[model samples]
Target: SQDQTWNDGGDFDGTNTFICEWDYEDALSASVKEFGGHSYYVFSGDCYTWEEAKRFCENRGGYLAVINNQKENDELYKLMLDFGYESAYFGYTDKEDESHWKWVSNDQSTYENFNKAEELGDVEPNGDTSENYAMFYYKYKNGAWNDGDFGFYTVNSGKAFICEWDYTNPTPYNLNDGNYTLHYTTNLGREHRSVDFDRTYDIDNIATERFTKNYQTDLAYILSVMASSAYTQGDLVYNLITLGFNDYSLFNYYDNPVDERYEEDSCAFSIAKKELSNNSTLVLITIRGSYGGFENGNLLNEHSDWYSNLTIWFPELVGFGSHQGFDAAKDKVFEQLKEELGGDLLKSNVKYMITGHSRGAGIANLLTKEMRDEGVSVYDIFNYNFACPDVAKRNFLRWNFKGKYDNIFNIGIAGDPVSILPGVPGDIISLGGHLIAQWGKYGNSYWFSDNWAEEYITYDTDLHASENYVRMLSNQKDIGNAKNWTQMQGKKVRNVGVDVIVKTTSAIPVLSGLNATITDTNGTPIAKINGNEIEYYTTDNIEINLNEYEDQTSISVNGKSDVIVEFSGIDDTNIEILVVSTSENQNKSETIAYFEAVP
Candidate 1:
């Protein structure tokens, strides 16, 4: 029996019941080391032959590094030198023919470096049969490659090698056109929510859970996508479609997305609406935050955003003067949102929700505060925030919300610095650059750690990245409940993760499943359509034909943790399977990620 431990990534008290959620990939590349579209590593002192090192790299989800140009070659050389290695192996090798060179990662016969001198003549690969491997001799400068026995070591040598890997973000997805595209907003690249947090609490009856859980992830993923400029209003609408909402449209509502600085819409906002089956309305108002990381949006519009984030004032005297930077931003957001959301919020049949991340998260929190001050109760609005900065002075906000902050879902990640910026963590009032130095946030606080890879892919910035929050939320959506709103507080809200999926090592693109059903050969009902082209059902111990459909080539499965999958007639590497186990019992539902490598 094989037992695999899955980290729920909630809290880490370091007991046997809870372990840190990280992987070898995290250990291998959980670094600040990244460059040129790949992760870099300098293996030192692990003396191994060329073949052994090659296998080592492959075993760890990487390859012996390939230096494409002199500049990159110098960079790697410097790194190895910094590690105090006298000699190191690169990807180029000629051991097979003793003359023909090739890159170890790919069998391309391209030779770029060969040691040459003014007098020593043909300094490399001259060892013929004895020296068939190409490596760098740190002693020789001016771009030189030497072919020598990889086992040969000097006192100063660590026998190091450069290893590299590609990040799996923006992974592949299935296209209806029979081609392949990357994981975009259209394809979502997620297991359609494995847990449900869409349970709503009555605003009038505040004795129970106040905030909905699922929206923490929903808004995290959505706000992260909105952080990217690659997406547009169309993408947001498409996201709503994937979330199982219908008849979606972007409602700008006569606002210019006005901000305090450059004309660049720093406080850009939009509203989306869907009609519920009970004649109720569902509204999602999204506020765009500065894309401070690799995201294109914050970089393009950062000047205005930075100017605003640093305002850093907190005085109740300046018209609800709480954390003036965020308060000012909220005012600007309201200028754009007032026309769309300012009117009567008392239509009990309409579910009004406002969400944002980063600066936008602050705006959402403050906007909810202002609305309450304007006579709208917690019963009237659902506000969700993520990667939120300290919004207001602790006492002021704690008092402002009238001890009722459950309608405001304020989410923070464990390693995310932005969420705790402008002050220290958990400190009620901290100093900032303003007159009234007080900083804190108000809302029902929830925290999560990045579940994708256990460590940082970049620097501290990775902790604050929007994508990590989405991936983390994608893993465990029910850590807490932040759900969608409905007309009546008692109305049952549709939960997320109604659909489940099975994942593989991605030999093919991603395959997934919906909550559909059919009968198998056992006269029992097999359920769910897992992916775009191919589909499968959930049950114990099942076998199915992989090539039943000619045009439909994708594969999807719905299964339990102990389910076994056997495939026949579908041996190509391009096929993907999505499996889902939608047992009615919530506790019995486990995340099934079974992967098989195509040999």
Candidate 2:
């Protein structure tokens, strides 16, 4: 009964057919026109005033047409001529302001298509303040825009209207459904492997959540109180305790109080154990960097110590020896850890993670290596370090032990100079100059060179700031995968509808054999390959051609080729599409894009 046809007189009947010269269906007779990837539908037998016409289109799930360009205006004129309508109301109006016209749908009218002809001779919009509606004029002006009054005679009676619907708005893929899991992996060269833990799992979930939270807390504790000019080790411990970590209990803390002048250059370590909400225990070790003072070993000491302490020891090979200022702090940390683990306070089953920024990161790196050498399983230890300098020399980096510690991930912000360390010459020299430049200028003019001084002064201080490290890590916590070495994760999945476009940039002409495979999120092909074709599962009624969709089109100006594939019934789900291409003479297939997916 709902599908019965309606006659022209607005009567629904089972037998009579509603016919129009243009396309007609159900109760509405409409004609379609496309321009700039958008489709416009002009409905017939619907003559309503400007307000009524807008409401009619809105009820049908579209707003009145907004012609914002010459292409759209030309298409609309053709649509009107085909329908044989002299004039029809569109979406623009100035009812809100006299001359400030806007589209009724969004109130934005950046492009105006108002008529500018000599024959019309200011006859267009002549009603001025009296007219508020606009219509496409097909008679006197031959497909130009004209203004009309809302209540004036025939115009007030009703007018055919055009409605616009955008089909290109991509539907977002939902991840809440339990059927799929996002898997990500990054290729770290030299047999090193990094896999993103199924975030849905318990172990990874606890590790990531706790690491992000406690790391931020420790950073804030160091910056606000420990790095302050008036900071003392007693003040540092009190402030950390007041921060209120859940189930917090400090196991040990160490700071050397004997060196009073350099005491403010506080290199301290704290180990705390906390119970996670998921009924698991987390052992957190946080190392705090120095406070800002020349006497206290801060940036100046870190730079000088790195170059001065470079050593070439056997077995371990080239390595950076501990700085004299932080040697006491480092020795104290190991001493406390050895004592605490031997006692009944620490457990073997609890998760252990080390975190720090800048100089603290340097200490944490040393602790990780020490723990590993003591026969602690690599799987049991995790390191989340920010702006960590390269502590080990070239030969030490090539060691088997360094390659096996997959759980240690050093997060460096894009422009962080400290992360790249003494390799960044500008930062090292800048630190040196900041500490001794004034002394050279007044006390010993011969100590400084003009060229070296100029270069040091030009270093980018903003890129090496501790605050930047904190900010970058904080922003990365939500999107960065905790289990992976690189910050590539599920957030890269885009909602690009059912149709996916794979673009390849190469100089080769005409990819001969193009094939695609639908895979699960983990890169396992689900479709079976028969000869050169692969079949994907879809619903019973829907029909799709896997071969026809794989045809390539040339985008020569950009030196790229594009291939499109459509996957029906895969809506609202996550899927990986693997596309491969081969040139005419090539025997081996080339993988174009891998790990490309829709969420």
Each prediction's total of clashing residue pairs, residues at least 3 apart in sequence or on different chains, is 20, 1
For 204-260, candidate 1 gives per-residue lDDT tens digits of 122122344224444444444443211233334334443334433343211112222
Candidate 2: clashing pairs of residues? 173-599
- For candidate 1, what is the TM-score? 0.39
| Candidate 2 ranges with C-alpha deviation above 4 Å | 1-205, 208-266, 276-280, 295-328, 343-347, 396-402, 422-459, 477-599
Compared with the true structure, all predictions reach lDDT values of 0.49, 0.42
Per-residue lDDT of model 2, residues 512-561, tens digit only: 23334444445544443232344645332222222111122211101112
Write down the lDDT that model 1 would get.
0.49
| Candidate 1 deviant stretches above 4 angstroms | 1-234, 241-265, 292-303, 314-320, 394-402, 423-437, 450-459, 480-599
